[model samples]
Target: MFKRFQTKLLQKQVAGGYRLYTHPANASYVEKLVLSWDTRRLTQAALETLAIIAYKQPITKMSISSIRGVNSEGVVASLVLKRIVKEMGREKSPGSPILYGTSNLFLKKFGLKS
Candidate 1:
């Protein structure tokens, strides 16, 4: 089961940072204590593309687009920028289509070892 208590505590901690309102004298202390927000957002399209890549790695962009029934070029670019995916080079075919695969970050995040 999920650890509800731990999740709640983390939420409280995140909220409490914003509630630290006091005299301007406490600015330094507040700034030091408040953690920098890490807004690591992944779009739904990118997530779907990632799932397809994870299970069917070394796949061409054309194949991915076919499976998703939509263009995944933008999503694939975002994944590459995030270091969650990498180009495994080109396919030995007519167009030499570029192949993509999950990177170490993807495996670490998904708890996959291979």
Candidate 2:
């Protein structure tokens, strides 16, 4: 596919031993890129929420609370705010609580493949 070719091109362009040079503008870009890539740059709450969601996906906030033994609402909100997790629509069950999953941004940030 075109995507595979693009990946190969990018890999060729940024071969081994490549490095980033930091000037004022490049430094700013680097900072933003690093923040986007390093999920750890997120708050502790976000990290915890992300872990819970990753491990127990398709789970509700109440279930998360039962497992984590604490309210995870705020942490979930922060992850959504940071574009790390996204609403995957709603469950078809009684409450119709929102479902969520990590976004492509999360994979890109963490250098993970789908």
Candidate 3:
């Protein structure tokens, strides 16, 4: 009986998957902390790379570099480390370059519905 009750009370499914819900009091505390947390600013190159990837997702590093007129490897790596971008897949062409795209975290961070 306890197990059944716990199962019903603990989790709820959203578009992505099931998420554990916190108690109302704890939820408020966590929300406040998250709102107050300070995030480091991205570098100019990182910001430029991120913008390109966000706008033209599923794009490759070579394409980004071409558009920016500079090497974007380090910037892309930084974005990936920050969980702002992710590798989607390889492009269907010679050498099959890896494609980059924004993550779900990107949408959440930017307060996007999709």
Among these predictions, the greatest TM-score belongs to: 3
**Which runs of model 2 end up more than 4 angstroms from their true locations?**
1-39
Q: After best superposition, candidate 2 residue 61: deviation in angstroms?
A: 1.6
Kindly state the number of residue pairs that clash in model 3: 0
Q: What's the distance in Å from true for residue 88, model 1?
A: 0.7
Tell me the whole-model lDDT of each prediction, alpha carbons only: 0.78, 0.73, 0.83
Model 3 TM-score relative to the real fold? 0.64
Q: Local error of candidate 2 at 85, Å?
A: 0.5
Task: Write candidate 1's Cα lDDT for 73-112 as tens digits.
Answer: 9889878866789999999999999999999987876688
Across residues 7-72, which tens digit of lDDT does each residue of candidate 2 receive? 333322256565434445356666567556645577776777788887777667777777778898
Q: What is the clash tally of candidate 1? A: 0
Candidates arranged by lDDT, highest first: 3, 1, 2
Candidate 1, pairs of clashing residues? none
Candidate 3 lDDT, tens digit per residue, 70-101? Answer: 99999898677677799999999999999999
Off by over 4 Å in 3: 1-40
